[model samples]
Target: MSVKPGAADTSAAVTTASWLPLIVVVLTQIQASFAVNALTVSMAGITTDLDTPATSVGTAITAGTFAMAAFILLGAKIGARYGTRLVFQIAVAIHGLAMAAVALSQSPAMLFVAQAASGAVIALIAPALTVFIATNFSGDQQAKAIGYLAAAIPAAGVLALLIAGSFATTIGWRYSFALVVALAVVNLVLSFRVKPVPPQKDITIDWAGAAIAAVAVILLSFGFSGLNSWGVILATDAAPFSVIGVSPAAILIVLGTICAQGFFQWTRSRKAQNKPQLFNLDVLKTGAERATTICMATMMFVGTAANFLIPLYMQIIQGRSSLQTSFSIIPYTLSIFIASTVVARLYKTYSPRLIARAGFVVVAAGLILLAFTIRGDWHQIFVVIGLITLGLGQGAIVALVFNTLLTAAPKELAGDVGAWRGLVHNMSGSVGIAVASVFAVGILGTLVSSQLIDNPTIPASLKVESGINLDQVNFVPNDQLVVTLENTSATQAQIDEAIRINTEARLRALRTSLLVLAGLSLLAIIPAGRMPNEVPALEEPQPTKGKK
Candidate 1:
């Protein structure tokens, strides 16, 4: 296969490009997104059908994200060796097959397998996509192309929600994944129209660096994921084992940080030897690039955390249906799509640091507003307003940071940008969901005891007699909660009072969690200001041979 002509001429490539290939790349993003989002709407269905706990579904999500994050760098190297377009096509095919498997999954274990398979395929797609875009377009055209793809990402999630809502009612949740397969097939056919991208035979995978990066990211993700089940500070009863009653989650994070440092050292050594690096360490050498990277991860973390928390509160706590969850999120998702599509026009009008700092402010403001407005009813207008604010900010940040990183490096290092982005995105998303979920749960547990102690309806004698375990507090629907109270020796008035206490505590926990996240978002403004103030030069700024 031959690479299309004038691939090195970014400006010329943009002027002469066809839109079909770009559309194909965007479709690939939608395909992968559909697979990732299938579980969000089907959480209750899967948990019920497989007779498994909710944690099992979270485990599947984590497994998939972890697999993708761990293997992405190697996937980029492989893509370079074999040709990006070919690797992308093959990955799409595998992703389709994985989606089909998910459709027929009969157990939680099988579901995890399906998710992991899809995840591994997604790792390859990242690098391939980066190379494809780099080879095809540049300058403002590249920014617009990336913006459209980013917009499509949320559209995919919206589509997944609708598919699940429609099919889960008529047939079952299994049909939801079947829709993912259908999209993947359409995308696969369109991808063949993309021009050939040839292999970079000189590039090779570094197995040692790969191992270190993989293990480090996996451990960091695992640590975060464990917080909900294994306890935040100490080993909970769910934990299989512990070291001095300390949380295994904490231990893993410490180990992961050390490994990350080792990875950097190894990359430096590889560079000094004149070997190509797994990640483009050259790009990361600057303070601006590093800040941009952190801001990118932080933006994703907020979005992921908010998404997880919202769906959970609606579907699990309020006992609302999947369709209700979809409807509730419509404003936010739509706002994001609109913002992502339109914000590319602002590139020339504003500096990156200014745009990024403003984005963080908008997001933080949204979080605070939401914190103050949440009620048992999940009010429509206020929630919509708050989410729209958050979405507008999120969309701008994602688009700007993406263009910034890609522009900072040479076109040939597009795969490097892609691989690192995949790692950061998946890792941050997993950690965000895990941290928010467990942190809220921990806060709820603490508040439940205090609430029971303060409630006038529950006398000290009744607290001992009812045998209610405040330490094991968790959010459940009112109906399930009634069943739980039935097992305890309590009068009707006392039961109602206890349920009210639990509900109030849960609401309080949500508020507190949002405030914490908002504070974190506010903290990010400092680094957002450190991002490069202008677009980088198009000329190759990488180190020359033997420079290290």
Candidate 2:
């Protein structure tokens, strides 16, 4: 029997259809990239148009991030019960509406609410995407496709910043969100093309588990974001308990953990004999998988921190235009795309662990170089870090973790494991952004405070030169640091000096943060080593598979 081209050939159909699932997954991730960076790129215009305080605007971002972390697993459950295709449609609609609402927000409350809604969509869609791909694809296709999905996010982010920044500058920041609505529509159309996979028959969403997880993530995110806010954490010296009780960090660590543990116990109690449980305890039981997951999150966190800081520094300190700011981030997008799409494939032959470990070493060395060599002549350091160091680390992490996690998971529970992995990665991204914001605020404030004390003779000029209006500066830094700096009133010499100082501070902070990431990256080596050295021989799913 001669095989007809693109007709009645199972292998060809599978190959063509394989790409469709990946496309769907990539589309889902794109929504999040826009959500995270749209606000960042549009911050300047949004703040001005809405007449909201900068800190309030910053808090809106925090709210969105918290909402995502809280709701991601819930999304996965939805995908499991219904099919991923159905869930994707609903998510796209919600996310699109949220974006539209964000564009029309009249108050900070409206903005925060809209952002949170969008974040929830982001949280759910990401895991659903991973689960969908895991269930649909097999063997090397799974690893390579996951890498593409992983790479698509950062690439989308870079494009979003560029487009948003350009549009926000020319038209308005509110208008920039129109892109999301458009993207959502395109993604919605794309979703129709994705074939439905078998659905989980016995899906049970643990509401208590979901609730506890949400509360815990919100509290933890808040706590991490408020790291610089000692007063918020400590309250008054006389009433420290009040501060402690309200502190997100404290609640997440102490109360959140209790809730999470209770949820786990509840899941165990509810699980039937030989039935798979939500949040598989077995996955965590594997030391290598556990470490790999943690490392996955940390890698995303550190990369996000760099992405967050570089833009703010460029805009706030360098006074670049939005278009210029976005352009500067091009290297990151290019590098990550190349590594994810190209380098990831080589993992089949080379040890993924070695590739990932080398990535961290390069990243650490790059960060150190950036920290030590930041001066007036060292403006190109951002590109080096983004293109080479950060890009390599991110690429390898995607390739390594996706490959390792897939290998470790049994065929029946692949979707769940993939969802869990996506959860760790996305939540870590939020945590990273929040943590970076905290550090950025502290860095700006401390620098300004010191400058004021040192140059009391020229305090007014110093204030302007340092780019520190404590209230406004506390707002999250985006890719527009250059623009923010240009808006300041420092003379050339003073501007140069300020850039010099801030650059050093940022570089040093980046070094410290990346070192933490390097340590985390090394942790994955053990787990990757434990992964099966070769792919198992391909076999079709048995007719009596437990999933359906």
Candidate 3:
């Protein structure tokens, strides 16, 4: 039986009342999506205000992502037992309160705690929304509905960044959290329309699996998050004011791996005893399922890394205002929407594999172009390359991952698979941002050490005003400090001169990261080639006996 009670009836028409519920679900989903953007925007603000290191701020994001992934199965169980409508209400409420607290937080610890609560709430809401859609609509309607609904995430991201930049500039970053509270209010009011599903009687909740998964995800995410820290980047040489410690990240990674293996064993043991397991091992053994999961993770890792790094480069290095940087990325945001809409149409006529491959090729070609053409004289070339390639890749990624994952999974296991898909996508995004930040930091440090320019004296007032330690400023290394100085109230002549030198090094770092992404993208080509010309897995729903 499908998880949702009435979702598999393809021949039935949606009632007028049904539309309101669907709209409510979409609105609720947008709150979590808004968090994705809010977190990214606030990364800089938190680091600046709390006197926390940039890498530490970055880690908090990864921690939240880890929490979200680890708790998704638990969220699914909550939905199955307590029902979707109630679970969504609780999720929405918890998330809103957390956002409010985050806005008030004065320290990194407080921010991390707030993020953890928000992550838990996100896990509860995301998968339940998917199940609600699946159980409500079936057949082609289901596919089309999900495609449009899924687009809300990126759309919310764009909206959040736009609002955050403007509000932060005028009223301060705290006011940006007020935006989420307002959205939550709308979501709460609209949630009245979400019709309740009857709770399942035989549903099994796997507390053991949930605990293990949480530990594993937190450990793994923490490890990856540490990649952005100085401890890992410069292990041997102690630079000025650099963080010194054993590899806390590495230890967490090892612990996470162990937890994962243990969790798998526990699930298998439950199945062996003829008890219900949280996940169906049999469903995951298929090649298509495995391939689809891998592809989703890879795509998210690359795409998210690019998104995080590009904004940092523009706002921090290029001395663009946050608003200007947001506008610069407007090309990326619009390209995703435009290409996704067009590709949805094209997928009906052409093999998705072929279309997806074309997108990958365009992305690789564009990145390669940027690598070679990045110079002061050729800045426009980089913009053009980013626009064309990023558009193609974003469109292709959404269609390929969403469709393929859904098509490959068994109909009965759709909710479980959807939960896993969301988990993978978010986890990869977290890691991608972490890994990319690490490389960026390392590159900046190297640039600083080369001593190609006259190093400016560390501003005493600036450190005091920002409430950060002088040692933290010293740890910035040469290259990044130059870029930071260029963006500040420095003389225009000095800023221009710093820009010339900093641009060259920044281009080098950006190109190297893009090359790595290009290589990861090539892995998708083979998997895409193997996809069936037609999606045979998705058949018309069998008619219910009474209806016929």
Candidate 4:
């Protein structure tokens, strides 16, 4: 039943294809996307239910993405050794079980573990989706299928927001994950109808490289995530451990960077020795491919940061309900879905470099608009416009960069391309959320402390007596702040002043964070310029180069 390496299944040709397989692929994608997005929309409920901070949900998100980035290259090889269909089906089943664990999670620890498990399973599913398309379809049909798969990410977000938001509001956040469990069962059933890809039995798994990659990513994720809690430059009270008075976050980041370099060096040595590589370096042999990766990572970082910031502001800062937060961000998610679906039309007319550069400009403009216009209201016309504009740029770039990479590489390396894509996407997303939280929270803490010190209305004696650690301030709703202050010796007037200071400080912090992200969006344009000036024609793959 095994086909020759890189050979397509002619039975599933474009003219003869039923499109049912694409549906299965897209639905499988939605299953994972919904799990992540459901967690995002349910952030408020999760914090209350688990008696944890909002940052705990962000940590869970970081854990999931970090696990995926760490293991995806290995997952791609696993899919190649085993049959893609069999591995994908098993991953989907395991992912379903993970989602059920998330639904039943009683603590933040349980939630983080469940999410990380789901992410590891997605590493298998992500590459399989690409391999399925490469093996089953040819020509424009393959292009069309890839577009649908990309669009499904944002489409899943919209669905999760509505469904999960409703469930979180009406019943509880747990029901949202229960719904994903159902979707997983459905996806698993439909997967049987998809075209099968035979295993490449000769493919070897690089265990050493996998171990290096996993350790590197784990360190980087924890480093970035702990920057605030563990102190940016020195160990804080919250840090579990430190190295020579320096923050463990800083130490971990340095070690991670070194390990990442070592991984590449080890892979290069493996390539020279004619041994199997954990990832196919040939996929990135060209500058255009490398640039495409940078562009992809930048877009994901900015987009994820913005997405996280908006919801954090709405739910945690403004005290909006989960359903209300979902409704507010609908325009953004809907725009992403629409843009991802239709961006392929431009591939024929414009070069990727042109489209990608223009997309960055649009994204920068949107972020800048958001920074200046946001206020007490989340329903403003300008805010909605900004969200739509940002989403449009994000969607177009995500789809375009992915398509460009796939077209540029030979068909045999499709899984590698997909693995690299998933790695960059998830790694950047994890860092994005981590950095955004740190920046926003850090700024808020600084502003609150400064204001608390200088304010003449609040007596210094009362501040000292309040016992609130200004250095460790966190974002809390005004009512909660008031209750805490009321329990202390502070009078009503002092509580009112504290509330005013917190409100203004939170707004200022968010504005500052958005502006910084907009600057990053502008910087990404440099890499976009290095993308392919012309569309890459999908040529028949060259023969396998002797199997490494």
**Candidate 3 ranges with C-alpha deviation above 4 Å:** 1-22, 39-63, 102-112, 171-175, 230-246, 377-382, 439-503, 536-548
Clashing pairs in 1: none
lDDT of 4 by residue, 393-440 (tens): 998899889988887877778899889989888779878887888889
Model 4 clashing-pair count: 0
Give, for candidate 1, the lowest lDDT window spanning 10 residues.
Answer: 1-10
Model 3's lDDT to the true fold? Answer: 0.67
Please give each candidate's TM-score. Answer: 0.90, 0.77, 0.79, 0.88
Q: With candidate 2 superimposed using the best TM-score fit, by how many Å does residue 33's alpha carbon deviate from the native?
A: 1.6
Which parts of model 4 have CA positions greater than 4 angstroms off? 1-17, 39-63, 100-116, 168-178, 449-454, 468-470, 487-497, 540-548
Model 2 ranges off by over 4 Å: 1-18, 231-248, 269-277, 312-324, 381-387, 411-415, 433-548
List residue ranges in candidate 1 displaced over 4 A. 1-16, 43-58, 106-109, 454-456, 537-548
Please, what are the lDDT tens digits per residue for candidate 2 over residues 53-141?
A: 77777888877766777777677777777777787788889999999999889888999999888877776677667667666666457
Candidate 2 lands at a TM-score of 0.77
Q: Distance (Å) between predicted and true CA of 52, model 3?
A: 8.0
TM-score of model 4 relative to the true fold? 0.88
Comparing candidate 1 with candidate 2, which one achieves the higher TM-score? 1
Best by TM-score: 1
CA lDDT of each prediction against the hidden true structure:
0.82, 0.65, 0.67, 0.87
